[model samples]
Target chain A: MSDELYDDLILDHYESPYHRGRLESASCEHTELNPLCGDRVQLQLQIDEERRIQQAYFEGEGCAISQAAASILCEHIEGRTLGEVEAFDARQMLDLLQVRLTATRQRCGLLGFKVLKTLAYAYDGTAGTSA
Target chain B: MENIRSDFPILGRPLADGTPLVYLDSGSSAQKPQVVIDALVECYQTYYANAHRGVYQFGVQIDEALEGARERIAAMLGAAEVEEVVFTSGTTMSINLVAQAWARMVLEEGDEVLVNEMEHHANLVPWQQVVRQTGAVLKHIPLTDDGHLDLDQLQNCLGPRTKLIAVTGMSNVLGTINPIGRLVEAAATVGARVLVDGAQSVPHAAINVQDPAIDFLAFSGHKLYGPSGIGVLYGRRELLEMMDPFLCGGNMISEVGLTESTWADLPAKFEAGTLPVAEAIALGTAVDYVTDIGFEQIGRIERALLVEAQTRLQEIPDLVIHGPDVDHKGAIISFTDPRVHPHDMAELLKRKGVALRAGHHCAMPLHARLGVVATTRVSLAVYNTSADIDVLIEAIHYARKVLRRD
Candidate 1:
């Protein structure tokens, strides 16, 4: 469990996170913090006229599990519709990470997914932000 | 003293994956010794009964044991009277008792409650809430760059309205022991009372409440290698008598009429309902156990381990140890590395069967003062040896390799 949890893929993603910045022209942005570990994730989405995600970016601080999970989530959410992201489940996020997490680490693995889903729900394409 | 680890049964066990368990989070709570465990089992298995109220033989025996435990704790603290030692649930409850019963009664709207920025939330939050309720102002004495209290500012912080000064005897995060004697003297000159939070100090150091400067002290038994759910609040007898009861119930009241009630005397006035009898008795045994080992010997062994740990940890590149140098610190070491997040480091270390604490360590304000959101802390106990420190160093290297990309 330990070796698989810190596999090479996770380590690579954590070291060089993809889309690791805020989108100034984001239609809606949402930030969430795991108070227990002080893990933070700020996810921004630039939705187009068709309500598809034109761009997705994030920036935050946390453990490897959380940072890598956010980076993996950014790659999956970009170019997807807001409705598609809202339908994403915790199991799919766990499957994306390709690691077995204990109950405590599961929160870290899903922090990005939770934040994106929250933005999807609250986003009315009004160009606003909530933390 | 040579084979103290043998006395602690948990230290002999292994983790689920068969890794030798290296328990290092003693500042949170020390692993219990077999004698303390046996004392708890003896209470329930043989003579479990309600204490202080029972008339039967079992009750009488339990009552006598409770008083005996009180006497042992009083002697440990060097209290003039056993009544000064009031058993509470833990340190948080003890401080809450003082805040509610003492501060609420004496403090006016303009009075000041002085605390330091380095205090654990257990000591800080209670005073915050108390001052809010009493309309008194809550102020803090800032910390120096090395994490020691800024005592030079104490004279300015103390004034006529300074009614109480609450300070931690030793910081849980930095392990810096404050000069309680100096703080007490400063408070005395201004005619203000002092309450020393000994949750971190009393377990690792020897304290004598017989000093005229100290007015109140609170500590938890779990940190002293005893069972949880038991703590001691040593107050000056006069203050304990004058303050109103924090909790009122069966044992804490002398008489109750339709519209009036009279509280019980001394310790009972604060202790309400049934006490944690088994835990208290085990705590007494723990006090005796530590006394038998003697703080002088404990301090020597722990200081050696701490110096060795500091020397090895300092060798790690990019790792920053917080607080004063080893000479002024206790058995706790808190550090941060830029390459590895504290949570990640702690989780990886746990897999290697090296248990440590990470996060703000309940000292968020102090962490903020240090300019870091969190840190990984390895706090030592009597059962821990230099061998355990070696394991920790090796684990840190493994963590760096696994976590750092460059």
Candidate 2:
């Protein structure tokens, strides 16, 4: 189980993250931090006139589960519509990771998803209306 | 030491997956010995009653046990009087008691409360809150690059308005043992009181609080190999008498009239309600257990283990230990490796049956000062042997190899 969680895919993403920087012309940006272990994530999005995510980038520091999840999330969300990204939830994020995680690690794995969802909500002007 | 380990049944048990457990997170909490466990069970099964309430035989016996625990704890601390020791829920509660009851009473606007950057949150946050309430300024004695307190700044930090100096006797993260005696002497120059947060020290060293320079000492039982929810706060007798009661209720009152009430005597004045009787008694037994072994022998064994652990930990490539030299540190070793995050290392070590603590260890400021988000910590207790250290080193090596894979 641990091997699957830290597989070559996840390690590769963690070692050489994709879209790991600030977006100079970001349409929306959001950041979140896990106070328990001091893990933090920032997601910046550049949305087109059609409300589609043209580009996604992230910057953060955390364990492999979180940092790799952020990298995977950035790769998954680029070019997707705001509606589609807004539909992404914790369960979907875990399924994307494709591994079992303890409740605590689940939070770590979903941090990027959370930041991206928040950015989508803010873009849609429906932030703080859902759980 | 092997016999001592035998006294703790949990040390002999295997992990859920049938791996032999190597418990090393004693800085968070220690494993209970069989005697402490038995004492708790016996108290609940037989002669169980609310202390200081009933006149029946059971109540009287329970009351005696409570007071006996107090006396034993006082003796262990080398306190001048039993009344000087107050029972609290834990170290956090003890520090809050002094912060609210003593510091709030004495501190005025513009007063200063000196602390250090290496303190755990329990010792640091309470003072911050107190200063916020009283308009007093809170100052910290910075740490040197090697993690020892910058004692040269002590003289400058103290002044007429310096009301208190709250410091940890030992650092839970860096394992640096501060010289409380010297701190007390420095604080005394300005008539400032010293509160030694002994949460990490009392369990590993023998402390004598009878010195006139010292004002208060606080420690929790769980860290001392006893039950949780039991802790001791030793305040100077005069200071305790002069301080107002923190929590006022039935047991802490001498007289009560609808709108106004008088408080009880020295110790009872602070103990407001029903105490944790069973935990206190078990903590008394824990004190006896440590006393029987003596700190001299415990210190010798722990020092040797610490030296070996430090040596082995230093061998790991890119591993940076964050603390003073082993000779000046206690039985804790915190380190960070650039290849592996502390949380990842901790998760990997747990799978290998090595229980270590990771993250800021409730010292975020210290972590920031050290320029890292988190670090893995291996804190030893009396039950931890060289074998456990070897296991920890092996697990670290395995984790590094797995994490650094291209």
Candidate 3:
């Protein structure tokens, strides 16, 4: 109910989330599973021939961090190169959230970025999911 | 002894919001006293070395300190042998070890393990894991409508295939103090081993493992006014000796060159690598502190708080207390305020300098059985006073007024 505990950017993103749904057709897709907290997210991306992200869409439910992170993330990475998207990490996400998270809650904030990064690596035709 | 309140330096400290901290989340993790903290600091500063390995002066000193801690814990639990104690990371890890070692070693396909519906995940998950690995069927002894384990149905649940029975000494979320002696006796009649999860029980009351003739007992230091990252698993020496080691590493191995190796004795076989030395030593001091004050006095102080809290909380309309029908529960109360969500209640209490835990309290089944999504829990320790209960009740009323406008 109060934005005091959340970052202003995160609160704004949560209040007015961007790219909050799935693309009709997508080139790459990823899902983040936080086993500890049971927070889950599935991300779908539509990319062009140049390997630049044309549209990034995510649809999932979790705590505020995951929702806001996914919303804020989609807004930031649209039309960006895969290399540029992989550069976003936990620190940047936490900075965007505008609040400090405990060791347990950090996974919630990092869920969206982790999924997207893995997808970015997949887009480059790289193997494995831990990107 | 000075006010006993002075023994906890953290109580004298202020919160980040400049409010005097009111900790009501002892059921989650108890706050440490000055004595426990000092004991830990002394152990690390003065006697810092691995246990049972080195022959040097510091190593010998550290070994004595660590063994001394184990002995104190054993004595506190009324264990017959010092060798019964095994130090672990926490109660979760301790229960996991029992599952890995005892259940995995002894249990086989067509065997069964019986647990209760009210058990915490720490008590429930390990049994599930063992059963999964061993091809054993895991069964639940049903809970009565009022939350007591149904002894009548428990007999039906037990049969020829029942290999083990694991249950909690006290419900962490519901605050019910189960009749573990009766449960152990029932399990023994079928020739099954019993493991008691004592994480919630140890701090609230005195426990005697010998009286119950319990096969194994496990508890965490942090839940008993000591440090985190430390727990004790006490198994009957004969049973422990029979079971294989859970973790095989440096300290657990007796001799290792290349292909062949011999394991250490009972307790050491389980404790591998660099243990939580500081936490173990602090646990000894915590035992001493509890003993000096006497368990009856501690129970009295807590019981008074519980009684007052129950009476005061009942006065609030639409407040439902979850647990057994009897008044013999532990010094903890889990309740749902119909007007407020538990998470919102916890957040509201946090702003008022009171710390409480919200959610299923790691006992989701119990919460589910009670027909509620979640509840806020207020657990007590020896340091808790009547004034603390008053503060909590006052805060709840404030939360209701502010948050419950529907």
Candidate 4:
């Protein structure tokens, strides 16, 4: 089915969503919610040796912004380390997503970025996992 | 009635992509008519003056305008007197006024407040807070499978200790037209004062406060094709005289000294400092416009819309209607496609130039009782037509394909 409702960026993320699962024996976990719209997401991260992000996956149910944001985030940060991910913020993700989000939806779309930042805080100056 | 749609300016405007915007969220807020706009503009341009305390020419003129607006609203509701009408900031504030003024004065530790499960949070929360403050138990009357209030259960709920009953004239979610007369009768047996939430009902049909013998009736101006931030709370003159004022200010108080104070009379006592004078006058004009177009005509059109929507929605196999399937139901229609979440459905509809509400719709208790988490709601008004329902049907099919991945 063709969804003319969504722009190309959203359609791309919907069809081939990234970070759509959970990382096994993950190194970090965080949850985010959009109370107004009832959108929620729980993200789990796994870091391998050499301080590289081995995998990042999230499991949750929400509107287009959240699903597309998660997919786009995973696609971008799969190979990057915590340092690279921490450097980015809501503005960078909003620029990448390139969609018109209301004030509340911006928060929903940026929740993953916030969770990743918190995980980066916990993983600060830490040694990589044995995996 | 024939030219009713043309009176709305928004209906003539196009969306960003030049698609005609089909508005179906009248339950959230009704579109303003030309008469309402003119009334608002007239107040700002010509009759811009403070009311009540102005002994001068402009003050007296504004005072007359405000009192005339109250009388018009009273006539619309079949209220016994104009003094029974107290203007405030929409239905939420009106309800809170009753909860704060009357409930605070009367309710005691052992008393109970009876509320229908179908009430909006505005009505429910005030009573909840009141009960918490007074140590009074808050009891709920369950809704039937068809979304109608269970009168039998209501009877059981209204015991000797029951002091108040707050019931919705119409369920905003289910479109169920509850029998307010019967609820009022039952509550009367327990000597309980009833406040009818007419926010959803008065917009779709004519309401008579006196005929129902309801102690209080509350409705918003915006929902009835008027301006926002304005609403009317109609209480029996005796009841209004009995209750204390909720807010204190210049207009509400009669005499104030450093040590002692006295309050104003009737409507003025309830209205605080500065009032929404323009909105109140515009509301009166809206009532005139609605009366001229005829509520019976509006009801006939709404029935047609409901029938068309029900037929189209029922065509989808997984679609389930949430309320009583009767002609008497209001124009509001809420339903859910089994495989699709309501939020996705609403987004898809928006892309098709359709505007509708999605989610629990602020009636969490009723939705929870109905055994569904959430549903998409397409509410109708006089401005809506059958063609809008057709587009909504096509949009729902499109939503099913997208969300269900069929």
TM-score of each: 0.97, 0.98, 0.79, 0.89
The digit string of per-residue lDDT tens for model 4 on B1-406 reads: 3478899999878899987888999999999998899988988888689877678877887888878888889998999888899999989999999999999889999899999788889989999999999999999988788888887787789899999989888889999998888888887888998998999999889888877789989999999999999998999999899888899877998899998789898889999889999899899999998888788988888888788888888888979889988575898889977656677778788878999898778887887798765778889999888778888888888877776567
Give lDDT tens digits, candidate 2, residues A1-131: 23756887788899999999978887778889988888899988888878888898999999999999999999998989989987777888888887789999988999988888777766753322222
Worst 10 residues of 4 chain A by lDDT: A122-131
Candidate 1 local Cα displacement, residue A33, angstroms: 1.9
lDDT of each residue in A13-103, candidate 3, tens digit only: 6556787876776787878776543456788887776778788889875555667878877877898988777776678877766677766
lDDT of 4 at A106: 82
Interface Cα RMSD in Å, per prediction:
3.6, 3.1, 5.8, 2.7
TM-score of chain B of each: 0.99, 0.99, 0.97, 0.97
Write candidate 4's Cα lDDT for A1-131 as tens digits. 65543566775675667868877768777777665555667777777766678888887766766777877877777788877887877788888787767775687678777777777777743443221
Docking class of 4: acceptable
Q: How many backbone clashes does candidate 3 have?
A: 0
Q: How close to the true structure is residue A77 of candidate 4, measured as C-alpha lDDT?
A: 78
Q: What is the DockQ of candidate 4?
A: 0.34
Looking at model 2, give its docking quality level: medium
DockQ of each: 0.52, 0.54, 0.08, 0.34
Candidate 2 per-residue lDDT, tens place, B150-209, comes to 999888888999999999999999999998889888887899999999999999998899
Cα RMSD of all models vs. native, in order, equals: 1.5, 2.1, 5.6, 3.5
Q: Clashing residue pairs, candidate 2?
A: none
